[model samples]
Structures are given as structure tokens and as C-alpha cells.
Target: MAPRDGTPDATGAHQRTPGARELNAAARVFALLADPTRLHLVWLLSRAESDVSALAETVGAARPAVSQHLAKLRLGGLVESRKEGRRVVYSLPDGHMKRLVVEAISHADHQVTGEPWHD
Candidate 1:
């Protein structure tokens, strides 16, 4: 198995190929992000941390639905949450997830607007 970019090593050996477990885990992440509501929640979180109430209002979803989506994202390891007094504030675990969400949205914007993609 070659790298995802399919670049061959000079020595002709597989370099850092993704294992089945890693692929499955990544698939789970993508699956969780497949939902529009979850993607919106993640995009919002990418901007800043917020509680469920604010997320619900911003995304025009009910609190329970937003909570459920947050729970799924938390379980999927795409987001993390911590209690702030009576509220559970949610955020992306690291900068990588934020970059991933931002890039995904940018790609979608290009696709929707028929904009030229740049390298």
C-alpha cells in the first residue's frame, strides 16, 4: 500500500500506509461530518467555543438536536466538551480539526460557486 497521495518511495517500499483500523477510524470521522447539522456545528465550533444553547440558536436547530449532534461529534473525537458551570462548552480538540473543517468548507464553496481551485 502506498501513501494516500500514491507517491512511490525511491526504495519501492510502502511508506506510512494507512492501516485498516486507521482507515475505519477516518471513515467514522467523515461519516459523522456527513450530516449538514453536524458539519454546521463543527464549522461554528471552528470559529470559537460555544455552549449547546448558542449553537442551537445559531444553527436554527432545537437544543436537543444540537445536543445530540454535539454528542455524536464528541463520541467521534471530532470535538471535545468541558463543563462551564451549568453549561457544557464544545470545541475542536486541536488546530488540525479546525483546519480540516475550514478546508472542507472552502472546497464546498468552490464546488458550489464554480470557482477555480488553486494549488
Candidate 2:
């Protein structure tokens, strides 16, 4: 079982080693997040679902740029969108993706702020 902190057990019974396919898939995810704007978009989505205009305003990018980033993210399976009237609201699909995005930003924060890391 996983520990309360979400780390795997020392016995290694709680996790399985990833295969090549899994590794490649994860690599693709990292590649998608490599862009700063895309990463910022994901970070915002992790907190709440929003539309193109809102995301564009918040990220301070042009609507077309944000739309392109969102399209890439959606195609990569990092996000999903649903139609609400005329607007398309986007959001992360699962808890794992949410945790991944949050943890990545947290790591960046620690690195930039020179803060100590915690388990």
C-alpha cells in the first residue's frame, strides 16, 4: 500500500516498475509540459476549470496562443474539455494528473525560493 504521504512502501510491494511504453508515455507528458506557457496553463487548470478567454487573460497570452497551447495539451491527454453552452471549459482528467502538476510546481517553487524540500 501507499503511505499516507503517497510515497511507495519500502518493501516495494506497492509499486510496479514501469515498462518502456509507460516510460515513453510519461516522457511525452513531460515534453508537453516543457513549454512554460503550457505548464502555466496546466497549473491553472489544476486549481479550477476555465475557458479560453479566462485562460488567455490569466496567462497574459493572446487568445490564439492560449488556444494552441490548450489544443496541444488536450491532444496529449493532459486535459479534457466540455461544452457549456457556447464555451468550452477545460480541466485535468484525473487525480494523478492533478497531483503531478501540483508537485511539479511545488518542486519549482522550492528550487527558485531556495526552500528546503520535504517528504
Candidate 3:
């Protein structure tokens, strides 16, 4: 088969060589943020770096629960952890994280609030 321009009709859909590391990194980041608690955690951290206790209170969850979320975030590289005395503070790994959460929430707000989307 051939395209109108005489190129192969394959449509450039051939599977390119996979970049496993890059794809895995993205997947891991998303997986870490997949939890409802983690999403809220990111929002809180976007407001400012916070410790597990504060985050647990803000999210209305147990400190252990928040710790689980933080562990995932730390492993996925979506967040960084530090020690302030005996407390562990967590923050976005970089500026892009803040922008990502803000833009995503804004997009969701606009989408849900749009007239076309309203019931």
C-alpha cells in the first residue's frame, strides 16, 4: 500500500525503539502521585514544604498513612525529603512539580466548571 504522496501506507506507526528508563521514570512519577492522599499532599507542599505530622493533619489522615504516601513520593523522585530536627520535611523535587500540579488543577477546575461540562 502507498499513501497519496507515494510514501508507504504504514503511516509512520512503526514502533520506535523503546526508551525504558525514560518511560519508567515518567510512570513511576505518575504512580507515586496516583494516590488521593499524595495528590492532596502535593497541593499542600505546593503551598509550602511541610512535615508528615502537618500533612497528616491537613489531609485528615494518620501520620503513618501520610508516611506511606511520602515514601512513595520520595522513591519516585516527585518529592525530596529533609530533616529539620527530628521532623522530616517534604517538598517538590523541583519547580516543574509546582507548575505541574497548579496547571493540572486549573485545567480540572476549568473543565469541571465549564458550561458544557455542567449538568
Top model number, TM-score = 2
- Give the whole-model CA lDDT for all candidates, comma-separated: 0.90, 0.92, 0.80
Better of 1 and 2 by TM-score: 2
Q: Estimated TM-score per prediction?
A: 0.86, 0.88, 0.74
lDDT of 1 by residue, 9-119 (tens): 775434667889879988898999999999999999999999999999999999999999999899888999999999999999987778878999999999999999997
Output the lDDT of residue 31, model 1: 94
RMSD of each: 4.9, 4.1, 8.3
Better of 2 and 3 by lDDT: 2
Candidate 3 residue lDDT tens string, 1-119: 44354243464432444478758876776777777789899988988999999899989999998899898788878889999999899998787788778866776787888834433
Task: Report lDDT (Cα) of residue 90, candidate 2.
Answer: 99
- Name the best candidate (by lDDT): 2
* lDDT ranking of the models: 2, 1, 3
Q: Identify the runs in model 2 with alpha carbons over 4 angstroms from their true place.
A: 1-14
**Clash count for each candidate, listed in order shown:** 0, 0, 0
The Cα RMSD in angstroms, rounded to one decimal, for candidate 1 relative to the true structure is 4.9
Model 1 spans > 4 angstroms off: 1-15
Worst 10 residues of 2 by lDDT: 5-14
State how far residue 95 of model 3 sits from its true place (Å): 0.8
